[model samples]
Target: MTKVQFRTAEERDRAQWADKFTAVAEGNLYRDKNSPFPIHEYFKLGLLGKEVRMLELNAGAALVDHMVADALTELNISSETEGNADEIKDWHKSIFYQDTLEQTARSFFSCGYAAQQVVRDIDPDTNENTYTIITLNSKTWYPTVPTFKYQEIREGRVVSIFSENNDGVKSWYAFVERHTKGNVEHELYKLENGNDLEGTKLKIKDLDRFKELEDSVATDLNHIPIFQIDMTRGAGKYFGQSIFAKIWGNLQEISEIKTQMRMERIKHFRSLLAAPAQSLQRAQRVDDGEALPNNSKQARVEQYEHQATFDLRQEIMAVPPGAQMPQFIQRDLEIITKAMEMIRDCLSEIASVTGCPRSVFNLDEKGTIHVETEKKKDRKYVQRITQCQKKLEWITEQGAKTYFQWKGDKAGKKEITAELDSAFEMTLEEKVDLYRKMNSDGKFISQEEAVRNLFPDMTEEERTEMLQKIQDEDKSLAGSFGDPVPVEL
Candidate 1:
């Protein structure tokens, strides 16, 4: 007797997990449904193996994008002091800072951390040094070592390595960037002859053929120019865990359930035709008039059964004359309903793990029975969004300070501040209603306070202008109504 071994839950690889999460986040899962990858293993089962539908709700992308949208809503960053503030704003505009921050947040939420490189360049028009921030691919960048406090970069530094393949010449080369305090180094390497770059056992020696593009630059900053924004860091761990890690199992189950439901629905639509055993044993005429080989009748029946098995498009099943009329096999559709319920439960589980509302996943759209519960979930989700916003705010402020430090503007570095939108999980109508309710009976809240609450992104100047306009409108209404004399009678 032979013993079969199975992989334990603890034996699952983190890299494989990351790859699955990335695929879901990027909407790239099951590109070829027939592929024998482990991720697609569930679909390749039962009688409908090859024909099983690949239905993915892409909950990973939805969760990350929705959280990012909530976290970055109406985000605004400004300077608190005078020197080089306008220049900083201009640089941000030139580099599309808001879009870059959005992409950074997406990456942080999707991949557990976002890596960025600060590149300083000379402005052609002003001939002044300008700073631009660019995100590094998560797979290419590696951060080593972290301080016990705040998890800031320690002595080990950061390295970014990427490979480029030149198909025309059949060559593979690698670009490496090393970032440390006050210095950045760049190097290029070519793969050694007969050494495959993709080989599992390939080493640094295999890519040891140094190309001539070695470069290094020294900076005045006290820390590395690279920034790594972690989603959530564990104690003593250099890398953070992806937000999808907790909900990945639920996501997988949801996909499998949805796929099953789809297959069940297909089965319902194209019911199986049941006939007598000998009915389908007759062979059709061959175009070449070839004689039937031995066991031809059994082979014909098996072929017909295979063709008519799970094919949704097969509308007719022919049988021999005087044979019992084929009857459709009725399936209990209650199984599909049960599967749907299971999917909703899985989504609820995902919502619980992600702090996102189940409504965000498009569950229970027809009624408000779950409205209050979803609102509570929304509030909790908003709190998580606030936490994410704070992280992004810190990153933005640090990025600004770094830019100023690189430009030698010490005053600007001290004064830079970043603010992300604080209002999440509220519609504009809901906010307006809340403001009306707060001030309905009496003036519990002033107009300025209401405006501040309703429109937190407005600048002081804008707020003042808006208040003046409101006051003028009130005076005009009072004049038109002539409120003093008519009410007493």
Candidate 2:
């Protein structure tokens, strides 16, 4: 008999939530053939007892992607101070912070939380320290219960564990990385059996298989190197709640309705010919008074039915004398129309829950979205995005600080800051028009100020160079036109 280890409540809950949200985010709701959900009916469709592909309306993916795109569009990260700003920008580019930032946001929105580990190493060519950010799989990474003060989470520790399975090996290895303030720990253990339970407490028998593969190692960094982003925080909750959880019911309803409509179409779209049995039998008889054998009569009736069906596909068909004409059954489309209406309603609810506009998901059948209404609803979403932006900014600053700390650059560490653009802000054209109008009215201080307003991401050095280039261009144009004619006042 094989002994089984059960998962702890915390682990079980996290696993369930992660699986549910992941399925929705990845549009795999019906991947499980035995799923009890109504959406599974979509995948159960069969022709001649063989299952066929079914329609899937993945509203969850649409919602998550739309919000994430809105939040992270035109994202710009930079140092807040002039000190080492250029170096920090270069570091961001070297580490591909933009891509990492988008990945982190996607994970956070889809999985309720995201974790990243900062790795510091030496560059082989320059022998200088290098820093890179690595996004961790939410399922493989666990955070300890956070320290709380006055009903708020102050800090938390993280542990990243993954299993390594070697080919042709019965047993596997587990690698664990633990991060805490001022120290990082690494451990490797070999499991005698492959049944070591993950995200659960170990039993005595399970512990017996845990053989140390190497001595434990610890690194002191004076700061926690793992950065985490949580979608929403609640009191005493270790992990945040996924957005999918709130809108899952609506998504499932939409998918089920879509599946139902698809099934209806498959069943009703074909032209079904209806005729009296007598007509078919009469058409099969060679002569009106000819008496055929029972077996032959049945066979002739079936053959005549098949022929009639095939003939119905043509523009005209000839029927036997005294035989009734077959009439085509009309399909009722009211059910499909109602299903579409229900889907639109569910989309509206999802939009409200997600703090996004219904237009994003094409829920508006009128093809027009109310701008003011959308903007009003988007305010709360914008605030949420701003909060996430701040967290990402903090993460970037922390990573830069860690890099500088490893390099022994105390000033750089102290001066590093990160900035991100608000996705909901005014458009570039709108800003340009406003600035141009202000400058025309003499409300502006100088051209530099206008330039700063237009391009806030540019460094002071870059701004100076840009202004000089403009001035040199103006001088060249003036020279090209020759000296201006002197006019007496």
Candidate 3:
């Protein structure tokens, strides 16, 4: 493969973007030196523990990651396909729902962004078709160009993608290069040597070039094909802001409240475990007119030590005259409870910013959940999920189309695209009601559609059987009870 060299404006723009991408990524991840996350400081101050938490003592960063990512997992995506389209649709189900993809998304959601490339593949032995969706760590992905709106990556918005890879011994670099030659063409680049790729001859390789990339001295692109999935885009910057930006202020408040609560608890427990000692002054009658020791300090110390030595466990102690036991006050449990309320309040504010409900973080102050309030919170949460699902739909479409095309059935693209819907789902009850209302005025309702809503978890065969039984029962009841036969009566 030959390397193409160009000094065009587009190439320079890509180079310039590489510099800015690193800064943007670091800032988003809170890894930049000037960033305000204070993660290290939190650890140093004992706000965040060094040990991994089996039970989360602090709901700071971990809580955010879990709430956002798990919300995304709630999305139900499926394609409505007919005939040959079923093959593409099945491939779509198989690829996108992989555990590895979900894991990648969660990791990215933690830091505000993620990337995955769909590469087409053809089996060698039977010439069967296959595809791979390779997930990339957002930190390693450097875009060739910057985009203002992340909803869609229009043509020319992203010129290329630069990603760094490591194999333990040395670091390797990969680039998904795009250039216009009548139309946009994508070429993958890697280093001739694994050591460094500061300036080297680039090899034009296929998408699978990532696997054998680390060892080869000559730049080579594996034969994997790239098409529409070549566009590098993922869940954009956290709601279009820095991942930690929304929670930064509230996070510190939570930490301070937690630290104060911990300190108060420790003091309270110590007071309970150990009681205060009584101070005593020995009023020994100095011998009247007797010669006392010249060492007045030594004599007083000996007398005081005698009074201090006592068995407190016996509940009685010998003491000099005028001695008194110290009175103790128990720590107020109300103060601790009030502080917990403050922590909950801070979490509630954070939840408002994250589009996560207080209940998700277990920050319920009312003790009981209100169903209507929870439903309202879910609507807000689903709004965010809908935005992400829209992006994933485009990515999935490319994967499905690539699969069908490689299988020598390019016509399946329309079938796959037409039926693809990754939109948010309504409850079965809602769907059933909707269809029933639409058909209330003697309109025909597809039994398959109605049955899907009624018995969503049932298999196709089971649904079919259930629908048949309902139809048979309806016919029998109509015949048996139809307007009492007039002639027979």
Residue-level lDDT for 242 in candidate 2: 82
Candidate 3 C-alpha error for residue 243, in Å: 6.2
- Cα-lDDT of candidate 1: 0.65
- C-alpha RMSD between model 2 and the true structure: 12.8
Models 1 onward score TM values of 0.65, 0.67, 0.50
**Among all candidates shown, the one with the greatest lDDT:** 1
Clash pairs for candidate 1:
none
Ordered list by lDDT, greatest first:
1, 2, 3
Question: What is each predicted model's overall lDDT from 0 to 1?
Answer: 0.65, 0.64, 0.48
User: In terms of TM-score, how similar is model 3 to the real structure?
Assistant: 0.50
Model 1, 226-272: lDDT tens digits are 77777667876566778887776777777777777887788788777
10-58 per-residue lDDT for model 3 (tens digits)? 4443333333332332323233343333445555455545641112134
RMSD of each: 12.4, 12.8, 13.2
- Provide the lDDT at 185 for model 2: 53
Q: Residue 321 in model 3: shift from native, Å?
A: 6.5
Off by over 4 Å in 3: 1-36, 39-85, 88-113, 120-130, 146-211, 214-239, 242-244, 272-316, 319-322, 326-335, 363-373, 409-414, 417-489
